[model samples]
Target: MNLRLSGRIRVSVFGVAILIAAACGGDRKTFAPPPEIFSEVDADAGTCADRCSLDGRSVIRCSGEIEPCPIELACGGGSCRQPCDAVATEGSTNGCEFYFQPPLLTTHNDWPYSCYATYLVNTSTVPVDVGIEFEGKALDLSKAIYRTLPGEAKLAPHVGAVMPGDGVILFVSDRESPIDNPRYVACPKGVVPAVLRDYYPDGTQLGSSFHLKTSAPVSAAAVYPFGGAASAIPSATLLLPVASWSKENILVNAWEAWRTYSPGVQIVASEDDTDVTIYPKADVHDGVGVVGTPAGVPATYRLQKGQFLQLVQPQELTGSAIISTKPTSTFAAHTCANVPANVSTCDILGAQIPAFERWGSEYVGVGYRPRTGDEHEPMPYRILAARDGTRLDYDPEVPRGAPLTLNAGEVAAFGAGVGEPFVVRSQDAEHPIYLAAYMTGSNGDYWGSGRSWQTKGDPEFVNVVPAEQYLTNASFYADPTYAETSLVIIRAKTDGEFKDVSLECLGGPVTAFRPIGTRGAYEYARVDLSVGSEPGVTSDGKTCYYGAHHLRSDGLFAATIWGWGRWTSYAYASGMSLRSLVSTPLLPK
Candidate 1:
């Protein structure tokens, strides 16, 4: 017998005449034989051909044949399927499980300071039950009280359940005491503070890592020195889930002045017996609690779950390479840092660094919007090289002093003015680089002598999410303590126009995005989230700053949340989709 197939089934017989008709059908379309018919034929065993259906939704499998499926489709489970079916979408900052290590913000026990993990519900209709776990025990939200600063006697309210489209801030830790004064806004109901053990002491080398798990996907942001006196240095960062953790990362941080304060790096282990090796970019001063290593030297340490190790140095640690045996969460921070080493005012700057694999080759950044005056100060940005011979090309040209070529473990710094958007790309994807944006202190006297201390915003450092890591939607929180809170949004022109994006608060549109950059493939917009002198809470007693925000577009976009007060400011990427850009064995050579 001979059979020929042409987009349909055909059978040829030798002598016997057989008539085959559709079982029950009005259309006369031919159909492929069922799998059972081929199973009985011993000669057809181990022979299969896979073809995608015309609609591309499924596949048709033929027995006793050796034809392969299309390149995009794979033969499996008796059908043709896309190989990506088994691969997950690129990881995002939002996830159901998260690990966080609160950076050392201040060493003063008398100063009022608190660490907060602000949870933003991503579900549209479903309420998520978020659990804060420390020391392997789930926290009791009912027993938790509002975090208060030092010298406060009255008991504040507890945090409430995080409803859909709403957000709740959990007091994760404090400096000296357990629960101190709660700042920003009034405590919501059904919310509780994490246990005291969650607190990572100031200037101490100890393990105080915590985990956050939720019934549904959610986005989290961490603010150190969340609520403190005016003198307190504040910093914030968008927290990445445990799924995005990797075995290697590079430290991107600001400079450390003489004896004032130190730039630090903290590593938190997700699994027990994780060995972390650090390659310092600058000389690490000893006697700062943790043993220090010299420039170009490597030191290794072993840590367990719920534990963290911190390295503080009087010199800059940017471009430092951290390689670990297991996945770990890493953060770049400054105990207290001045934008220019000579500047008087200082503030804490901290942000979680994505793994080296997630670093991208291209980035676009805009300086923070001016806090008060019309004159915009130049924002400082640093680019760290992931591989040797990495050359940078910037749009509209970078500053005169900016280094265009950088080797492995090298960093270049430049300043960009507000409203001036810049794009930087490395030689290629193989030379991935990390970008960090900084906000100068409020003193603003670096260039001139007449600068005043009454300036609004202070020094801050925020990691710039690569253009490749942009997400379509991001759920974030704007801190209420700052007098000015705004979002610096960058959307691809290839996506829909700016009108397609929406910033919602309390289930309604809240922002009128004003275009900032006019000439670029990417558009930049600044949305002022300020709601009068009082932040977070609206006049009608509704929450305004803590809620879900969505940018409706198929293309990717990036957002950075910034808030500033008198000599204090915080900035962080709203959310990022982490994509591995390099192969494994990410250890520096």
Candidate 2:
């Protein structure tokens, strides 16, 4: 995260004292003529300086002689560049500033959820300007008020503009509304709401975080138990800007608690002291007590700018490990979870993670599809491991009890079903991992005699974006309360076949896709962005089902965005490419 270079080339002190007095050839007792004689006086004054051509992308100019350029080139107007230009610029989940913080979902008797933040304007021709603040108290002072209910009236941080492919939504935080209930879709016609002291419930203190500037790049998403409740159990992630925050992260999360509900990991700091640490691969309590950081011990914590730190337990913090010293914003939750723990309703699972230098050696799972007459089943996945040993391979096989070797904070898990798909990989990028994909419950019998599609949706968890963080274009969001919403995609081919990808929405395209797994080098598919009522969402304010989608592709791709219902479900991904595949700075010890 440090490339910036635009100018620098200086070399005078009378030309380095005449090249160190001509390398002392005339005496001063060979004045240090040993460092290879200053590398032969910098290779004869670097042939008039201005070099840089060992593949750092060309640049070696020097004709009239000016001297001083070549600490990897950058010589200003007279030529000698390569200071920055390798052409590959990719780091997305589009951006212009963002920093959400909303986990702790899934609730029924403790109610109080609703949070929002949908915006999408990855440009179609100008129209930008967005904004929203909220973040002001908590060094332990706690804040975030907004209770409204007596003739209600709060709304006030929507900023302005926002047109190209319009879709704004900001309602960050809730609690007042005949018992608050708005968890997925229905806030489209000019919705803004965000002012009861900038809402935020499900607590952990410090002004509950929320920022999101914008004047140009956009693509955010963070609905949380937001609207259309059947006892709301929603989820939706895809938010990752703050220039892709990262000081270190890893916590795949899901399955660790079912009855009293557990599995959590939230940390949001955005800067101001911010020191955070925390190892715990499991065994946490979070009734505060400063993380009670147990399982293997590590604990640290300091927070300040919109502070946050909530670490529930019930076991399963999947290979936990989050380091930080500024640049934080991680989330991997599950306050309900119940995929196979004897099924029977349970939901809420969050995502937002990416930073252990953007983990990924390769991946591509693909399950979740079956529902009409049910039966295909399987799903579940895990992976983890960010170092030590780490072998793994897998392709058209390897799901039955997975584990081809892992170590540093291990984790494996399996299952795949529903046209299968798989793909795994590791042993390369110095062994990177961290997959995660679960979603099963919903009357699970897998095949026995239950579930013919009655109330289909339950467990949830999603974090699979790897294939080297593929993304040619994406602008995701599809939640409309979820009676079922699809989109799995995958792509990647180009020279060996498959390419033309599209998707679009409300304004057209979206020709049903369909394919579903080609086995290895990627090619999945499975579209259908909405099912019941054939793709509903329309009523004056244009069209929507949690509107705003795009998805292009000329090559690299990757997506997810599921969404179930009844018992409830939700997934994430539809946006990635935050590059940086580790080279140091994982902060383990």
Tens-place lDDT per residue, model 1, 122-191, is: 4323456667778788876664434322112123453555555565556664433445443322223334
- In order, the Cα lDDT scores of the candidates are 0.61, 0.59
Best by the lDDT measure: 1
Residue-level lDDT of model 2, residues 1-589, one tens digit each, is 1111112222111000000012122332322211010111133443575443322223445443335445444332334443322211235666667777666633445545554445354432346665567665212101221111111122223344666555545555444343443432333333435543224434322335777666656677786656533545666778887766777776666566777787776778877777776665545554533535445556666777766666665666666667777778777877767676676666677777777787877777776567654335666776777776566666666666777766676775667675677777765665678888877676764333454346677777778888777766677656554667777777765445566666654343334444433443556756665676246433333343445567775566787877776767677777776768778555424
lDDT of 1 at 355: 87
Provide the clash count, candidate 2.
8
Best by TM-score: 1
Taking all chains together, the TM-score of candidate 1 against the true structure is 0.75
Candidate 2: lDDT of 127? 66
Q: Which stretches of model 1 miss by more than 4 angstroms?
A: 1-89, 109-115, 123-125, 143-161, 175-192, 202-204, 228-231, 283-292, 445-450, 495-499, 506-519, 531-548
